[model samples]
Target: MIRFVPADVGTIGQKRKQVSRACNGCRAKKKRCRHVEASPKDLDSQIQAAQLAKGDDRIDAINDDYATSPTADSSTIPASTRPSLQVSPSENTRNPVCQSTMAAPPQDTLAPRFVDGLNPEGVFLAVHSPQDTRGAFSHDRVGIWLADKLNSKEKQNDRTLTRSWPQSSLLAGRHSLLPPHESIRNLTSIYFKRFHPILPIINESAFRSLGPTDPAYILLQQGICLVASMIPSSKGHLFLGDSEVPLQHREFGKRVVSAMRISTEAGVITDKIVLIQALVLMWMFSDGPDARDVSSLLCARVVQHIQSLGFHVYRKSPDQASHYESTMLCCVWAIDRLNATFHGRPVLMHERDFGIDLAVYIDSQMPCTRLFLHVISWLDKVIDMYRPNAELRSSDLEIPFDSFEDLLVQSQSLRIPTPLLGQFIILISLPRAVFSLSRIWLIFSPKATIETLYHAVSILSCRPRSFNTKILSSASRSRRELSAERVTSLVLDKQVCQLTYFPFVPYAVSLSLSVAYSEMRHTKVPMLRARARDKLQINCGLLERLGEIFYLAGLMSDMGKSTLDEYDRIYLTAVEDYQQNYSGSCAALDSIRATERVEIIDNSNAVPSTSREFESNNGVNGHSLLTQESDPSFYVDLPDLDVFGLFDPNFNLDGIDAYLEGNLNLTYPTNF
Candidate 1:
């Protein structure tokens, strides 16, 4: 696969000039030759010859001996500098002898077109360094300079803004700017506006209640600063070296816990505003290490305080009229993370005796079945995300416990009203238990039983390592095939389903599986056997498709900024994975079998025929998950021009998709 070489403006300009000097035949062949120039009617061949005495360096660079047709000598030099010329001007001129060459005038055919300048029109050049070297400057400084430049440019041609709308969109509105302090504040407001649902929940009153110096107040203040720093207009990193931000948040949490320590130490805080903010942060950082830890701690502290207060699960205080049960569900997610990190041992929310209260609280929320469904579904996702691969063989999951089962049973008795939710919990828990139980079976049973158990568990889990074409192929033949129309219908229905109304877990699970599975299917192209694998390959076109989905979802959602952020994270991870894991050696490409092209049975199902065959051919018969096949087809077949579309993960999806599908086309280049 070809690496994307970043071209400098000078290199591109040079290439352009060389291209102009070459005749079509020579240019296509990359050969040096004189192009035919227009013969001015007034000037005879003799006069033209006389003008040649001045000796054009471009002409000198052209080898007349081999200037005919497609063949030409490439050795040439600029006369003044005595430097080897990359291309000669003679190659750029029009052909006089060819009848068709005289048709288009040079000015009309090759005039340079400019849209927006790097620093905008009429801005003092001193404010910005050279384009390539200016990345180090802060956004605030850049913004100020741009604003000044735009002010002047607008007077010349009011339509000539400093930044092109397309270019601004590419940055997702985060311009390389340096705004003044006031502008920075305004920018913060713009960012907050994107996540407005968090506003009523985290109002000034909440901060005021926490006291001016409280850690919760401090955390809110720091959040404000972080928001301030990210002002798209400027780069003022809201934290003014106040190391107290984290301390304040931690301290505030500690204070809450201390105040409620005697009553109920395991209950979750029911405050709607706090829960929204925490959930936002959690969703925004599904993959981040720091954010994950911080969110878990925050949720855990809240749960601790709630449990300490001895508040009835159904009980409401003047200050706790908000939905505490839903909030506890969010805390459950945090607890899930903590458990994953601690090797699957979840912390006890409270003593086993007090578990009844929490369970009762959960039971009281039965009328809000839909809400709990969403909450548990979201928890299901978080729980599955950090699922452990424990080495120990045990009858039960290696969930370390100080009497957690007793608590689970207590909660179980509290009456989860929804059958779908009950089924969902069973679905989530069964696989883990079965997988763990398989190991235990191996410990106590015969080798034959162990193998049976292993196969059963693997089949049920649908784990990547357990993938067997024999199994899926068999399943495919026996099971009713999901038709193309059905696939399309399902996709459309998914689009119509209001994500806000769905439980968070389904969204997380569906999103991760949908995105990752699509990527796996598309990118896992077979080596050399393009045609053979085409029909049979699983070319889900995941990178492109999922990228499109994320981009569009980001645009439509209220948390557009955070969605954009997640898209970037996913893109980077995908790119890194491609670069590190799938990149193959030149030898591998050369070794591809000639018959490989026909292996693809269908374009949609295309896997790397040769690459996968290579693995099987090598006798790699372990679980498919452990297979080491590198699917380089994505890197190879993907169009170079639109490869970086996800850089602006928040791009308009319908437009982009239409353009990609050849239904619509963009006239100008922007992503590159």
Candidate 2:
């Protein structure tokens, strides 16, 4: 999760000095207090100032350290129920200055301000008192590193880029990114006509009225063209004059983004509402073609900029507010939450940030807008449970499933389209299926593993229908083979991995593929391995198909292929081990069973030791991660390494959190 440190913490400590009597500032206002008593009050004021600088919420913790003493004295107040400063041995060890005489403030009373409003626990900083450590815990391994790096670089680059490139030159360069007038105008019309009906974040009539000279129109046009580049025609050309535009989909997106950044930095475009509308559209470009770092940096700026302009706090005034603003805010909230999970970091927008309730939209809201909000609200619940960035987590299988039933009931009541509803049901069922798989390979209880193995297999074999096949029924031969609308119509009519606008589908599918690959490597359980392999293949195929639509999924699909090859190597090692376990008992019998056919057989004697042996032997680093303390150690063993630590239901069940997880493929394209 995200964290913050008080800028005045060092100064607060430096200014503190031993005093027998109240100082001038305290003496003038308050007659009866020592200088030490004033320290706690000083801490509050200083921390508030620090939080203000960082643009975080101000804390309102009660100050109960004033009338306090180290020893029982005759001057002590009457024994009352009021809480006061007290110290324990643990607090004393951390603070030597307060160990001897100064009473430490109790922890339960002090409130640490949070950067990510949703997560209750994470690597955080506390500035309540001197007794409190500057940070809640060490963030050496669990902290958000990318956001920090990007945040620093963003400050430097935005300022540098603005000075290095003049507004006139930047504006001149932006035109080069745009497609020919006719080509772009047609593409924009197609996008609104085909895609806008499904995700109505922008109003069609009001938007088209604005001309090309308007900055809003220009930004929206650029964003739509970037989205359109991924969609190719049947002949594989974007426009009739495709030779004139040599830029590929990903490269085209990069140039457009750079131009948009320059225009914003130049302070030339001052229309806040339309600018945010374009920013929301840019996020739809996804993470691969357009870098995720760009999305994260933009999300931070837009959320802050929107709040600073009072968009979040006041939307009740009809003259100042409109349905478009409300719809856009939901889109922003969804993007923030989606990226927060994908990156496993803090969210910029919070549930309480906006006054509008996205789950229940106005009656006049478009069907697509309403459906999108409903889908997002359901997704938001799933994300909250995962809390991907939270430093501490309970075991997956142990968490109660009862809560999700209510979400299911709520979904059943919504007026979602039938095909879309079926896809959503499949999406929600994944967590349950994943939990069952985690119980099988990761758990040591043979009886439970054997039982869950069958249950998980049945679930995995039921492949999801991700695309809406019903749309294809309307496509006619003449419409596709003869009409000029063939290009746009095919993109809409042809089956896709899922709805083009819904972005989180790729991450869910990719993560499932990773876990399924992990589960399929056991080899000891024939049925289990076979079942997991099927799911892995299905997920990999979906991700591959999605690659054509979104480069993020393409990146994931590439990762999946590398993992598949790696798993084959691990399978070979497992077969060799099984051969070692069983010798030729019969003269005619084969020493080792065929690796491909082994999982298909259910004979108990044919299996060897658990996949644990495979993981320990063939680990990427090929080393034991355990310490003398038997503390949960995190180390990657390539394909078999279980760094996520969620593989085992019993392991890390208590307060433990693995320091790190995942085998990331950081080799990205040069366009980023």
Candidate 3:
């Protein structure tokens, strides 16, 4: 019925006009649109291609099932009212249009299929895998898997499992592994009060909040217990409820190892600041024949952790750091550096590696920490000056003298404002003794040795009377407080007495004594020689006093003990020789007194003699008269006594025992 209208054909080469039309939906919405007509086959092919492009093959099957099936009510609906199957080319890439001949499923049935996988609910369920056991993840199972992956054949064969994972169960323990909570609290309080002022590493609040099972807290607790056991006060009846309390140090050390194992199993050994703090405490408490070895190993481990944490390069961000972290880093660095110098091992870090400046830190808010940092810096310079391979030129040794003097001045000026008076005194005394020791090592002269000896005395004097009296009083108190059973049970205790509050005091005293002994033997001036002899006696007396303390503490260094024993032999020999020589002098004086008596008898009536006339006429003090008779001015003019001995190459401590012993008996009290 359509009439074909004749086309108005444009002339040849005329431009053709483009045609466009809007789709039904676009037209309903009144928006501009362009639509292209597609054949049914092409539309079907495009829909299939889109379904395949979605990467989920399930979509294709769903589409096919929908296409084949129709609800009973669907046929009643007109096909013309249905949605179109065609899609624009632009829409094909995003959402494909499918022609559905059946009614769509209920909204609830289709809602889950369109749920977003990235949503929290979806992600949690996927990770938890409620539907599949094989896909589930749990912390224990994950830990086991990690352990299996990291556990190597060599580790298995050696059976030396430094890492904690596989043996965690064995390492874990109940309350038996620790003291009672109250005991732990007391020890921890003691540690923070005594050691923390100098080494402020553990955060008090955080440490308190940690549960007993936490590896870091347990390790810290064990360290605290071990250090507290070293205190004389802790060994008394005050903590003697259980038989085990006295030997808690041994148990605490084991627990520390166990805690380290746990931390290693937790895969946080080298990552924890608390572990480093614990190790530092352990190192400080360690002593024995193997102390050097233990300290070296401990220091190495600490450095490893410190380097791993990037603390050597850590700089403060704009945000201020917590007191715990900053103080811990600073203290650890100082400990490592000092340990290196002491052991003659290579240092783990240099001054430049510090995040904070040592000079500035010395002047900062933490006054107690200043002494440690200052001493560490000076020790670093000392190490540099005396490195093993470096040539000991005169200039090389001379240059550091100024620095040493400056350190002495600085240390002397420091006023520690800490409640721990004993620890504070020791900390302040250490640098001064170290400076004196450095001088003794660098300059081998009587002047230097005597000066160093004087300095050692000064350090000893700096200790408050309370500290010295406490040593004697504490020993007696502990013996009285501890029952015989408890005292006997402490057999395993490795109590070590530091010879001086500062380590260098013993070394300086020994050197001074040796030098004084040499000068006493070789010096030509009788009075000067006598003065050196007196100095030797003074040094020996100090050694005897120190030895008494060491004996009471049940602690003595090999060096100190040997020095004491050798001095004893020398003193005994000197006393024996002096006694023999004094007997001969007494015989000579007796003969002279007899002759003086004869002279006094002959002159008594002539002079109407007083006691002064008797001494002037006959010289009744025969020993003085004999000395004057030998050399007129021997008793009158005395040479100036140099305390530090001459650095004579031929000087030796050999065969000086008689001289030392004689002078010692003269200058020292017989009770010593």
Q: Tell how far residue 496 is off in model 3, in angstroms.
A: 23
| Superposed Cα deviation of residue 291, candidate 1 (Å) | 6.5
Better of 1 and 2 by lDDT: 2
Candidate 1, residues 487-528, lDDT tens digits: the string is 223333422221111112112222322322223233334232
lDDT of 3 at 145: 10
User: On a 0 to 100 scale, what is the lDDT of residue 361 in model 1?
Assistant: 39
List runs of model 1 lying over 4 Å from the truth. Answer: 1-204, 208-216, 224-302, 310-375, 378-672
Q: How do all the candidates rank in terms of lDDT, highest first?
A: 2, 3, 1
C-alpha-based local distance difference test score of model 1:
0.31
Per-residue lDDT tens digits of candidate 2, residues 1-672? Answer: 987634223243456644445678777887766544535644454444344344312321211221131111111222231223454566445444444334322322222222332233222222222133233233432221111223335557877776556644655556666777777876776566435644565667778898876666777777777665654431133432235645565566666766677677676566776667667667666546446677777777768667766656664643356767665666667667656655555677776766755454433455544444444554454444434332143332122222222433443434544433333334445687684565321111111111122122212222112111211112221221122122122223322222343344454455455446545533345555556556666666776776765677776666556555554554545444444443333212322334433654545455455654675585412322321122112112123532233334444322111111131111111211
Candidate 3 has a TM-score of 0.48
Top lDDT: which candidate number?
Answer: 2
Q: What stretches of model 3 exceed 4 Å from their correct place?
A: 1-167, 171-175, 237-245, 248-270, 315-325, 352-358, 361-365, 389-393, 399-672
- Computed on alpha carbons, the lDDT of every model, listed in order, comes to 0.31, 0.46, 0.45
What lDDT score is found at residue 466 in candidate 1? Answer: 16
Task: Write down the TM-score of every candidate.
Answer: 0.27, 0.48, 0.48
lDDT of 3: 0.45
Model 3 lDDT per residue over 408-507, tens place: 3564424444233223234445677684565321111111212232332222221112321222234322222222112112221212111112223333
lDDT of 3 at 451: 28
